[model samples]
Target: MQRSDLLYGLIDLFESFWQMAVPLSAQGEPTDDAGPDPTQETRQLLTYLSGGLTDGAIARELGVSERTVARRITRLQEVLGARTRFQLGIQATRHGWI
Candidate 1:
């Protein structure tokens, strides 16, 4: 398998273990959408973006409008504290959301 795939898988395993081991109250962090990860749709969007797909292409592939795609990206940025697409991608990967 590719290095990126292995890294992503390992990150997911570690995150799953971390969640199982820690309680939310013990972590002392405010929760949103149930955890520190994006929703499945948001993860799919990030995957398309990381694969270098444009907004229009993603829209077509997902049967959504360009506007919808843009809005989702914007929402993800706000939720993830990202100011730009590059930052969003980085943050999503760091969160194991992509």
Candidate 2:
């Protein structure tokens, strides 16, 4: 019963979000034009993301707070006009930024 309940709940949640999901082609593009070139520090930070490091790991390597790592990632998302880290990596690669 619990397994079925969890399955049904997930299906319902998927259905709700599916109604609002954008189509695939639109999903590939960035949310906006690539803004100004990111600073060198920003590029370095994103490089760590490319290497599959978590925010805490990045903070440890960079000697900053985890919150600072997160903030830089958020800013990178905005600058690259990406909605997610995966998208950010794609956009940055496309723009030859990283």
Candidate 3:
């Protein structure tokens, strides 16, 4: 075969192998549609909180006020049903957020 044909055949073989190696999971398994939005403050807050940052620090990093950070954290706790930052961290970890 020509060199171009050989490369095309190799590409097809790799595509087949990739398709076989990554099968979809079972249906109705709980997917990750509940996590915080990537472009939102809640996700950033979770990241900072998990990284052991203070609320003031997170506020500064996010370019928002400390009170806003506190309020966002409070809302996040309510959404996750977490009573404390530790609990929020655990939940976020379990949800693959941090």
Alpha carbon lDDT of residue 57, candidate 2? Answer: 92
Q: Which lDDT tens digits does candidate 3 get at residues 1-98?
A: 44798889999999987764412234533233445444556677888988889989998999999999899888766665567788666656555566
Score every model by TM-score.
0.62, 0.63, 0.58
Q: Which residue pairs clash within candidate 3?
A: none
1 or 3, which is superior by lDDT?
Answer: 1
Count backbone clashes in candidate 2.
Answer: 0
Q: Number of clashes in model 3?
A: 0
How well does candidate 1 score on lDDT at residue 60?
92
Model number with the top TM-score: 2
Model 3: worst 10 consecutive residues (lDDT sum): 22-31
lDDT of 1 at 61: 86
Which candidate number has the best lDDT? 2
Quick one: RMSD of model 2? Answer: 5.9
Pairs clashing within candidate 2: none
Q: Model 2 — which ten-residue stretch has the worst lDDT?
A: 22-31
Q: Over 4 Å off in model 3, which ranges?
A: 1-40
For TM-score, candidate 1 versus 2, the one ahead is: 2
- Using alpha carbons, what is the TM-score of model 3? 0.58
